[model samples]
Target: MGTKPPSPWDRHPSRSRPERAHRERPTDSNASMHADHKRELRLYGLNAVRAVFARRPEAIRKVYLNEARIPQLQALLKWCAVHRIGYRVVEDADLQKLAASSHHEGVVADVLREPAQSLLTWLQALSSDRHCALWLDGVGNPHNLGAILRSAAHFGVAAILLPQHSSLALSGAAARVAEGGAEAVPFVQLGESVEAIAQLHAAGFALAATVVAGGEDVFAAELPRRLVYVLGAEGEGMDRGLAADCDLRLSIVGSGAVESLNVASATAVLLAEWSRRGA
Candidate 1:
């Protein structure tokens, strides 16, 4: 008999299936890179996604989803339909890679906001509002900043200001922690928080800072007509210049066993007390 023709699968002795690209391989790396370069972040988490929809629906360039996340995706789609926002479906792995972490929970949002602007202009615009501001002197960590932001929004602060070079803008990690507050609150970037405090002083706002030593007790200090509380970095506290600019250096009184409080914790205490003063 003539040699049997080889089956397609068995045709090549050493041939094997080509490795498939992972489902999460980013097809839009260039696009994502552009977003990163522009200081925009790819965000996930249900609340974070909801916040973006509620606050800046137009800011979202796209929304990606996986089959597993369809329930949440449906809700988002409903909202997007109402708002006229566009979105797409993708594999779960793609979202994980886009988020750059596994915490994405199968949903990712491409955010676009006006490039960060000076806190001064925002402060100037809010010049007439009867509200307070929080100046993060040098809080370097995004978690601390995001936590503080959540507290700020809940307590009704007008805005939160950070130093220009302090760290990245509201990141995905921050958005996750803030639980939607990140979008609700306006984050302003300033040249130097110390210099910003000076302008705040000139603008007739009371500037209070947290210090471990030689500062008035937070409970005892008389908050001003308009208040701006300055909380230092978690480890370094406030810079000397920033500390000096404060109208009053206030300290949260706690058990002496602990050397100091986390900057975010200190801020929550001060904001709570300040809010209580209003009530």
Candidate 2:
């Protein structure tokens, strides 16, 4: 399928760096305290900003910037102005204090944690015609999450669900790497992977686990129209109970020259196969 047109929010031109996108939060009593109750988090990069703005704007309370970084923050500021979001220019040192892991890249947006939803509710809402979902468990690397989302959107997978206790937010790098795939696909965070899998099975979804050992050969296995593909983290695969719960454990046939495929790469291969089977 051809790439979908750019989202309305993505029409802005790229300057020195991508602009951040985000929504606003109220400054009143209960709301302010709620925002404060959560740790003040900082997010850099354009797409991460966009995800916050597009998905949960109220969680974003402030945007800190520097005059020299004006171009990098133009679009985001414009978005804030139009949406009545709060912002101010602060010192680079202040930006440093707010952002934890990486360079603030001349911008940092204060945001509340992105909320997670149930896998069951998300799945139940999909049309019967749209029945495939990518279920990720313990796959914490943001890059891997973004890549898998990109593949899921590319293959028209119905939705992508991550365990609630696991890493589910679209991190800075993941957002950039997703190239807006984060917006195209619906996302959910589950309370427990094992329970979610069991519920999915009960709902008639044929659970397929990507595995390294004995299981059905992915390419040769006939897949059900309604399917959920479970992918585990790097090195270790899914836990025993979860693996056994799946309707089918699948391996991507290889020469064994390598022990196994990267979790993200394996997901891509499996999702592509499911899409192909539908075709």
Candidate 3:
């Protein structure tokens, strides 16, 4: 008889018999670590870490730093030791790994994530007639958010309002960029846009939609004593329906060389004008 044809299974034994290859499943410790990571926020940068320690030292779960940072962080380390919090004095490479960024500034802290406050609670607490807040309609860039927080803190903004279903959350990179402003500003989670608008109206606050063009000049306009500037995301801009519902619309009126200032830069100008008027 002619040589028997080789079976296809013989040519691909590994595929035919999958059980021959052993795959290791994640251990319980690995799974637990992942769950812990989800519950914690990795705050890096010297100022960012210091701010968390200053504001909520109890929230800090652990810390990692290079030897060079020890002198500057002696107080923090002492607090950590006293509280029995875990800390590691590792090399630069380990610090980078823990921070997930090279800009860790030689220190990193794992702390419990600060939860956003409800709109109703925040509104109830706002007794000041001369107060300002930001309604970030869709500004999701971390760097932009950080810059905005820094400006907001500098201008004494009351809060940062997040719309329903907003993906914006404080992150390590954003906190680092904020340079401790993250600790100064509180994020308020909003409900439905229309309902939230009504609530603000009831609280004697006016909403101003920031547009690229076809709006009152921000410099000359009479901004409300209690106002919320609705800033949109880059490129796509704010929702048209939301913009239409705003009490007023304002434009920065910059030189036509570029379309407009960055959202963060525009916020600084707007806040400055408001502060100047209130001053």
Candidate 4:
């Protein structure tokens, strides 16, 4: 048969993807924090802000958009007006300042961040036997995180499990890149890795460590009914100890031209395979 057509999960092998106009760096400084003791998040881009308005209108504290975007955001503006929420029509410069990014796409909003769910709470609420989640070991890039969230939402992933003390919270750039997926998936904070692993096992989840090489082919392996794909940091890869503790190790068999796919791309491929297997 001829080469199969590329699916949505397919990515070009070239590493020439265009970089964003600005980098969204994470910081604990006060300048990075939003209102209400940093409980709020500044979400920019049309889809990011619009998703917040559509899903949780009351959480939107303020909105700033250019005059040109008014027609597109009529419903959001009307909702703001009805709720007495402050919204301003300003120049693109002002919008950039408000969003702290040049790629704000003419709109921005400050919305209260949804609190993370406890692992036990999420586990208790999981009603489906066939479900998948991502246990992000050290994946910290906001854009990558956003891409993962988008894929997770597309594949019906149950949650993004964050390890205790992991500084990887959703950023504005991540949310913007997610394109409304941020509202669809929930993030669960995990406790100790040992305890978390045990809890996941008890909840009928098999933790599979995604490795660069020397692991079972993910495409051919029998996936668990309930699974958690453990993804690691970009450069360092997964912690050796954690990988050893995992129930199984899996690798995405790719052309050897490159070392491996980025965490986000790999996640999409893995999730697609898992979803294809009817997980």
Clashing pairs in 1: 24-93
Evaluated at residue 37, the lDDT of candidate 4 is: 37
Error of 1 at 249 (Å): 0.6
Candidate 1 residue-wise lDDT, 194-229, digit = tens:
577677777778888778877888788888868888
Cα lDDT of model 4 by residue, 1-279, tens digit: 122222211232232222233345645553444245378889999988988888999899777778788878888877776666667667999888877899999998888999999999999999967999999989999999999999998999999999898999999999999999999999999998899999999999999999999999998898999999999999999889999999989999988999999999999999999999992
Candidate 2 residue-wise lDDT, 1-279, digit = tens: 222222223343342233453356555875766657564455665555666667777777667666676665566666666665556666777777766535556667767654555776776676768378877777878888878877877888877777656645666567555655765787787766667767777777888877887878999988888988888877777767777878888889999899888988888898888888877
Misplaced by over 4 Å in model 1 are 1-39, 78-94, 127-129, 192-195
Query: What's the CA RMSD for each of the models?
Result: 10.6, 8.2, 14.0, 12.3
User: Which rank order by TM-score, best down to worst?
Assistant: 3, 4, 1, 2
Model 2 lDDT at residue 29: 71
* Model 2: lowest-lDDT 10 consecutive positions: 1-10
- Local distance difference test scores for all models: 0.73, 0.71, 0.87, 0.87
Off by more than 4 A, model 4: 1-37
Q: What is the lDDT of candidate 2?
A: 0.71
Candidate 2, superposed: residue stretches over 4 Å from native: 1-41, 54-59, 65-75, 89-107, 163-170, 191-195
Each candidate structure's TM-score, on Cα atoms with residue i matched to residue i, is 0.78, 0.71, 0.87, 0.86
**Judged by lDDT relative to the true structure, which candidate is superior, 2 or 3?**
3
